[model samples]
Target chain A: MTRFFSLLILLAVSLPAHAAFNIFATVPEWGALAQEVGGDKVSVYTATHGLQDPHRIEAKPSLIARARTAQLVVATGADLEIGWLPLVVRESGNAAIQFGRPGYFEAARFVSMLEIPPVLDRTLGDVHAAGNPHIQTDPRNLLKVGEALARRMVELDPANATAYVANYQAFAERLRTALVRWEKQAAPLRGVPVLVQHKAFPYLQNWLGLKETGTLEPKPGLEPTSSWLAGIVAQQTAQPARMVLRAAYQHAAPSLWIAERTGIPVVVLPFTIGGTPEATNLFSLYDDTINRLLRAL
Target chain B: MRTTLTAALAAVLCFAPSADAANDAALAEIRAQVKQMKESYEQRIAALESRLADAEKTAAKAEATAVQVATAPPPAAPAAAMSAFNPEISVILQGQYKNMKDIPERGITGFWPANGHSHGDDHSAEQRGFSIDHSELVFTAGIDPYWRGNLTLGIQDNEVEVEEAWFQSLAIGHGLGLKGGRFRSGIGYLNDKHPHAWDFADAPLMYQVLFGSHASYTQDGAQLKWVAPSKLFVEIGLEAGRGSTYPGTDENANGANAGAAYVKFGGDVGVANSWLAGLSYLQTSAKDREAEFEDVNGLAAQGLFDGTTKTWIADFVWKWAPDGNPSDRNFKLQGEYFRRTEKGELDCLDEEGVGNACDPAMSGATVLSNYDTRQSGWYLQGVYQFTPNWRAGLRYDRLDSGRRDFGVNANNLLVADYRPQRATVMADYSWSEFARMRLQYAQDRSMQGVTDNQVTLQYIMSMGSHGAHKF
Candidate 1:
């Protein structure tokens, strides 16, 4: 009996320590960003991946199970994930990551907005009524996300506050220098008329001084109709566009059709971190996007 | 062409001179006029170029500003994680496959006759088909800090239906506030929430018989629930909708006038562990108008004159764990007992296979009678996590049906029918938080000479923007 008790004690001692923090992120972009800030101090999981369309994700029992264990959660707010993420959180009953908790992080909190529709309606095809949720396309917003993430990490683990601040500073400096070079390289694209697959490139176009001649999607989130494509083709023929921009994850068929009809080069841009194999981190996402657009032009 | 020729002629005349002195004076005037025209043209071109340059610069600045602003931190927190006013939508797809053997020839009858048959016979490959068991898309939005609403649309077996749609106010402190729509009645344990929470993918025998194939426990109604200062909870609801038909008689054979009202009360007890017990009462009026049918020549008069039936259900759930850790081993025991009785007039026949002599005025007369049915079942479930990524569960359920009058009798006669008991066992292995593979076997010994068995294997996977798990 004494030996049995000793064995039990040994087994209990041998077990691994429980994870310190349980972090849930809405998408891979937030997951990767959280990892950069949390390092080994936290365990993070992403609800969506780069290969899938963010707008059409399906909820499953497994996702609910993950949410049940999270202590901290990060998500892209506005109406981007309004289609799915809230149900999982409420069902999970994770009080720590519930609304108003310190562990909850909304990445959109730090970014300024653009193209906010004065009037909103569902007839225009699943618009984010609050504006666009694709804020990660711009590099400067990422800098702000990094800073906000650092603050949250510090609050969660105050002992590592100095390290978090230092890391954030280093990341911001490197990003700022890179942005200057990217802006210079992309300067020649000023005033160039372009077509886009979705509203995902407003920030990019803003940065490069490019004109958005039109979008392939007749309306936001709506599939293109044959008539709409024909009209676009006719318009582009009469007044040519220099380039057509498409996200790496978008269906290539429509963009391909537009390119084939207009004789314009189609450039696939990485819309988020790790959106493409070459774009692994935040800085690399911008690098790959600017280089790809410049090459195509 | 004429205008150009006249202008050229006029210019030559203006430059021509008659004498040397006159020519010099005219030439000076011509030179002065030419220089002034040249200066004016130069000024206009410079002004236009400056305007163009300014426009380009402004556009560049605007573009730069947009980028800077986009990258900047938002003035307010994102509504996705913390805002109570935003709505969240979710879609789920689930499929299952089951193999049945030795199914009865009479088919498995239930509340609804259309769902009673197994689609195959005993000798054949019994049951083989894929079912989209749960194709649900749910939308939920928080109205404020203390109020929320939920709407769920589901499709199963090619039929579209509404599963649960209601609004709840959390600001009522210990009190619950609700309004509008149909939701699960707080009668039994399994009737109140999603079927995924059950140990097995399918519902228990008691649940199927009492509520029908998809369950009719939810109806268009309103309810108010309150949690007492003690651990007790009380709920009262009134509903108007279709009712379940089972045990050979369509409880609500008529189409429109079937409605019910119910009240339930339960409470939690125990110190270290926890246990809950609840009792519910329901009264519904039958909708069938064929209660007076008579076949004296065939001796098959099984009609009942009673239109109202009263049902009572008692249920309890007990949970135990040494450390109260879900990841570790734990035990749960749950059960429910239901008794239903109706007062009506039933046909009476003599033992000589002949109808008793009766006056014309007495034919199909109403008589006081009683129809009683009882059903009870329970399950003991346990879960043990051998590792973080692997866990195992075991569950067993048994159901017994008391004697009851069925529409048809043995040998195509008319009398009471006896349904035997049933038992089921399930074993499941969860591979990860997002994936699980389960195997279940169930047996039905309801008929004396007929016995049936079913084996099912199921796998589930999920993808997309899911929230975090609660501890």
Candidate 2:
């Protein structure tokens, strides 16, 4: 019996702990940021990939197990992950990463949020009262969130504080230099009236100063009906938009149909890191977004 | 007047030169004082200008640092802090219209009637026409940094019952969790899930046979679960409780009458597929358990059982969604099988005199001292979500009577050599995450020689703060 217990202990202690700090990010964007900020001091596990909608991903058992040993959890918390994050944390039983703890970090609180609703109601079709949670579309928000995430990492793993701070400084320097170039290249997109597939691009519009003409979705989350598309087609005869924009994860059919009818160009932006082949990192994500919009223009 | 004025001007001119000597000296003194004051004022102005320049330089440097990085720590969003102390509450309103035969005394064919089946008083069985099902009121909240509490009340018609009220530990390290109170035992896959979360409108024939009127095996208990610190999901749980529900009767005993242990393993096959499988065991003892069954002559008889029951359950589930985004489409397949054994003494209280209802030698009650039986049941189901709002499911259930040994009163009740089975199909549509409507049909052969065709239409709407569901 003693030998059996010793073997059990051996098995339990033999779990794979590859990194000094383990972080679970809810999306690829935050995962990329955590990697850049923590360098080799941390290991990140992204819950959802670029092809999946972060709002609707399942809380699979694998995710729960991943969360059980996580040292920190980074999320875009403007009610974006309200559906699944709470359940994951409760099931994980990891008190370090629960809400209000030092190890839990929300990115949205660092930057100024846009599109805050005046009324809170589900009749508006899944409106986030806290504002749009897709803040990663703009490079400025990424820098801000990265700075805060670095501080959180240092707080959790103080032994690696100097390494984390140094890495964040290097990353912030590169991002700031790239931001100036992206803004200048995207100057032509300013004041360009554009149609969007959904209300997912308010921060992008705010950053690039793109004018939103209409949305393909009838409401925030509802799919567009044929009649709504017909009405948009009729309106385009009088006043036409320069382009229709959509994210890489969205279905191409809606924006493609609109582009076909209006004869406008369809611009598919890699909304986050690893969303497309070209968008492999934080800087490339913005580069690919600007290149697409400029192509469309 | 001109001659007088010229004379006065000449006299004043004569005195002007004499007064100019004194005035010149006074003017020189006033000029010296003015120059001293001007020098002091210029010195102060130069000092103030330098200080302003220094302040501007520091301000500019601070602004530059702010532009380079976020200097101030980000404050948490005020909206995330809920201050009302109001627990998360959700109310589920459910109603169903069932169309089926009106068989008053409904019982599974081969399996012995469990508790709450006497005269068909089982609440698990649905009504004939339109009826309000068990609507649920759930409240959950964190008690403190270390614990959380949950309460769920099940209401039907004018009756209200506490279905689950438990408190769970929050800060137990080592991937360990503790829960205590009245809760549904986590023995099988579907046992812990509420009715609204079920794909079909009714329980399977296997569950109906084993648990009788109860939708799940519930007990007032305490549970301890541990999750292994591995990449692959592995969990082990143990439970002890007062077995006062189905299969075990409340005898006002001091110690625990039931205990359970389970272990689950799961992992992701790929980005699209995930699966979990588990095995569980439960044991309980009962005293004077009452049940109603038909004798060999087809007459209703009452039986009292006193003994121990042991059950083993194995469950498995697989879920698939393309790229792990279920909003577009998804599919789930689940199944569970249970084998049970009972060893006890069965005493027949009523001995009908007609035909060969008990031994002719017995009087009022017939006692079978060494009664031993073994029974098993299994169910499999598959649900496919073809669209974001529509889903369809099909399920099949079967039960085996297995072996039976009646010691003395063998002539009173003959062992049934039959297998009860059922097949069900359902389609449901959801307007949103909160509301769903389902239509289901089942060909039930649970009762002996009765192939009852059942159709049901049900609606479920959840309002208020509904939390996320478990896997």
Candidate 3:
């Protein structure tokens, strides 16, 4: 028994060490961005999946354990995961990846935000109230986030800095080419008036030069009401909006109601990573949203 | 009709010409023209009056439309119908079953009849019972942008009681202002919140022995907590009454008196990650009667005798959540330890058996003793979250009564009634923020020959107020 124990111990010590930094991204979009920059030098995990609502996720113990071992942590801060993420990080006890530390990254820092609310109040149905947290819908914002991740990855793992910088340059050039193509395709869509289920596509609206006529929701965080729907219908009837747009995961009732009342085709756009089968990566998420808008218009 | 005739006469003069101008030769032509103009004016005035009447009618119609829209019934849609009755009420129900065996005479089982039989079969194994540990109804009202109130009533073991009734003033920037009756003391880790927040259904051995199962540490008090200039939280509280039958205690001893003054200081540190540490102190006198009884009947009446004593305690807590995020499935651990020393007298029996000799068979009389029993106890416990919903915990407790020689009496058969040592291991699965189930097995071995195996299964839920407080 003693000899067998010794042999087992020797086998454990003989295993090859994994030097790659372990990273935990708050959402899948950040996870894809980390993978783009880190390549094989980092292993990444995302707390929220494609189909889940990122705002209301319950903090489970498993997430804390993952954060404990992580050398780097990335999140969409602006209170996107405010309900649960802060408590998880506090419990993990890994000071290296804590907020403001070198290993901590907030993707919002890299992108210029839209819909930065001048006033914030919870009475408005849990508004992000700071700024729009859906900056990923803009291709320019995605490139900025990609570059920030690349810079942070190089800072944390200096040995792999060259590879990370090279990867980011290639990704940035490809994104620049895609941006030109998308702008050409979206040129005809400029100044188009549209209605959406939620304010999740402000960046996309800016990118395509679309005017957001209004939202179907009565308030930011609240569900739609009939009176609110009636008011929307009255407004839409007078102004005659072109299309009703909705995130794939948002409740379909309000969008369908607006579509029925206004005689406008409802366009279900993938707003984030894993929102649609084709929108698995950050680039595809914006591409799918633009294509859907073009097809609907 | 007469009013219309008068209004026509006025329109002819107002629109045609003045009376002096009408008599001139040009006015004579004007008079023929005036007669024609008067006739024309009458027709025009009649048309203008009709148009004015129609305008009044239209104005009334618009007012009626406004009222109709204002008082219109909501649209008959499925979603709208459900939204009208916003269900803001939430309930949390908890149940527990405890199976305990070989209970020691000084342990929790000693407070109640271990078995159904009061005197017979002292060695018989006790059967378990199902208890409604906590069934609570909570009502929360969002009065406005700056005010909210929460009232919670709990039913435990078929007894109804109020757990929390407080109104919060959230408008105070960075300051949490609250006022109400029956609030837990801001002392120990487990004292500030409900039992559902505990890893184990039963409190730690130290808490049970020191404060009993309910921990009458709550008082009718007023407290003000403010964020200091340095960002740490400083709370100061004063209570006018003593501990009561509920979870918190009245600071006063006898009637209404100045109970006690308590102050706590703590803060959260780290930009994203955070650590919380607190220090607290409480000083209160036990009821004069309780102290006098210990001196007279407990010590003097028996051969063992002593003077009166007082009670005081000091506590500290430190917790760190390194990542400062609650949703991440990562390594999270929290541990706390508390120590308390209580001073009091214990009465003993005389050598002649005059003091402790009740019925010789029923009462175990002892010989002379003269001393005060200074008792002390401490416990250490910790929990680590394996996932967001699952956690495991371990605890160890030891208590020592200062009266070591009191148990040495051959005639005193109640030697089993002394301080004991215990250890517990608990594992729980929290299914959601409001619901969880726990399974715990504890082993208790006393200084006497008794040993117990206790297994408890508890299901807990919470609603209405804010969720559990993190360490």
Candidate 4:
């Protein structure tokens, strides 16, 4: 029995106590930012891949077990992950990383939000009460989130504070320059009329100064009714749009269906890092997004 | 005015000084009034210009928004914080339509103890046709930084029972967790979940034989679980429960009536497959447990049995989903095997006292018989989610009691070699995550010479806040 217990102890002692801390991010954008800001000071893991919808991924046990040992959890709060993240954190049983704890970081908390609902009801078809949670679509919001993440990493792993700060500063400077280049390169997209599959591109459109003509899904998260699709088709026929915009991770059928009938080109933008091959990091995410819009134009 | 001064050269000498002073003062008053008017007019002009500029800016914004709705500016709405620290509440309503050739005389096999059945009424299955299968009310919340709590109430007919109410420790470090209260034991994969969460409309026959119609493995107890830090998922759990319900009665002066221990390990295969395997052991001491059975003469016979029961179980599950997203296509295969052994004495006497040592005999005598029996059962099921919102599954259940002894029938015990087997097929469609409809057909051979053909239609609807499912 004593020997068996010793074996059990050996198994329990297998927890990784490496020099780098583990950071668990709920989405790809947060993971990319963590990697950029933390550099080698932390190892980052993304809970949901780019192809999967962040709102609908399953709270798998593998994720919970990984979260159990996470030194920090980065998520885009404002109830974006209301469907799964709460239970994942609760089941992780790690008090240090629960909501309102030092190890928990929400990117949306650092940036201003959009599409806030005055009155919230489920009848509105998945309206986020706090605001639209797709804040990372705008490059400016990414910079703000990166700064906050840098401070959090310092607090969690103070030994690497200097490295984290240096990395964050370098990344922030590069992002600032990229934002200017993107605005200049995407000038032709300004005031351009386009149709979107869903209302998820508010922040992206806001920055690019694009005008929204119609939406495939009349209501968020709800399949478009026949009548609503008819209405969009008729409306777009009366006033033609330049293109149909959709994210690389979004379903292609909706945008393609409209594009086929109206002859409007469809543009699939890389909404986050890893969403497309060209969008390999935070800086490239904007580059690929603007290039896709220009191609469609 | 100069002519007036000339009106009287002589009078002007005295009046000219006063008139000139009055004229100067009047001029000063006129100048001040003119300055005030000019200032007011300039302020008005400035206000009008600013208003015009604001109107132009707003029109430009509206036009910009109208150009491309793809990036259309959102209508300004004040944001209201909806975050609440209050406990999340959810209700699950399950209703089913069932048709069976005949109702079983007993809920479980004869060897199974009586307490496994419902406490208040033994005829819970009497209702036929359309019936409210169950109504479950659930509440979950974090009590504080150090703990969390969950309460589930199951309401059936006019009776309400506290199905589960437990508090779990959250501050325990090193992947250790502790839970205490009345809860379902973590012995098997399906045992820890409520009926509404089940893939099929009803429990498998093996689960019914080992537990009951409703899961009877739940009791007032404390459990401790440890998650190993291995690359793969590995966990060990132990539970101590008051076995007052089933094969074991309330504890005596000796100690608690029951004890249980289990260990589970899980790992992933490549990127699309995952599997879990577990082993469990349970032991309980019964003071006086009663169950009804058929005698050798085919007559109803009820008796009290006292013994120590031991059960061992092994379970395995494997799931494959392309891209790890079950939304499209997935397949799950699960199986569990259990063996139970009971040894003690049974009293078949219809007497005034409840004692296992006493037996029934003619001519004013009593005899006690050895209640030694060994039984084993197993179930295997496979479910395929061929498409979104659609799933089909098939399950097989079997049990064998090949060995049996009653001490040469010393107490006139009626022992027979009885085996039961069943096969079930089910298909379900879910409109959303909160609503589901299921159709199931089952052929049950639970009784010795009976094959019950049963069909059921079930709907489970959940509303309000609900937690995500555990992997």
DockQ top scorer: 2
Q: For model 3, how does the per-residue alpha-carbon lDDT over B392-425 read when each residue is reduced to its tens digit?
A: 8887766655443333332442332456678889
DockQ of each: 0.03, 0.24, 0.02, 0.10
* Segments of candidate 1 deviating more than 4 angstroms: A1-18, B1-182, B185-216, B219-471
lDDT of 1 by residue, A1-297 (tens): 223322332332233424567678887778877777777777887876564556644333345456655667888776676655665555443445666667678887667776766665545655665567887877777776777777777666655555555566656666667888888888888888998988888877777788998988887876666798888888886767898888876667788998888788999887876568888877787788888888877
Please write out the lDDT profile of model 4 over residues A1-297, one tens digit for every residue.
223433453444344454559899999999999999888778898887666667666656667777777889999988878777876676665667788788899988777678887777655666887688998888877766887787788667756666776787678667666766787898899899989887878898898988888888776776556688778778986777899888766667678888788888999887777778898878888899898899888
Across residues B1-471, which tens digit of lDDT does each residue of candidate 4 receive? 112212221221132223476598798899899888766655654554454345436544543443332333434444355556668899998888888865535344434634432333432333458888668999998898888899999887678889899998777645666688998988877788788888788777777767766754886777766676545666766666777767678765433566777788886786578788888877777876766544555544556678888888899889887756565578999999988898998656534333323333433334457778788888999999886568999999888864666664433546656778889999998766678999999988776677788888989999877777655
True contacts kept of 3: 0.01
Error of 4 at B346 (Å): 2.5
Error of 1 at B222 (Å): 14
Q: Which of the two candidates, 2 or 3, achieves a greater DockQ against the reference?
A: 2
Over B149-216, each residue of candidate 1 has an lDDT whose tens digit, in order, gives 77878765556677878876443321223344667766655677565446666666566656555643
Candidate number with the higher lDDT (2 or 4): 2
Candidate 3's DockQ: 0.02
Which segments of model 4 are wrong by more than 4 Å? A1-18, A213-219, A222-235, A238-246, A250-255, B1-83, B104-126, B252-255, B351-367, B408-416
| Candidate numbers sorted by lDDT from highest down | 2, 4, 3, 1
Q: Model 2 clash pairs?
A: none
Candidate scoring better on lDDT of 1 and 2: 2
Best by lDDT: 2
Chain A TM-score for each candidate, in the given order?
0.89, 0.93, 0.91, 0.93
Model 2 residue runs over 4 Å out of place are: A1-19, A227-239, B1-83, B115-125, B351-363
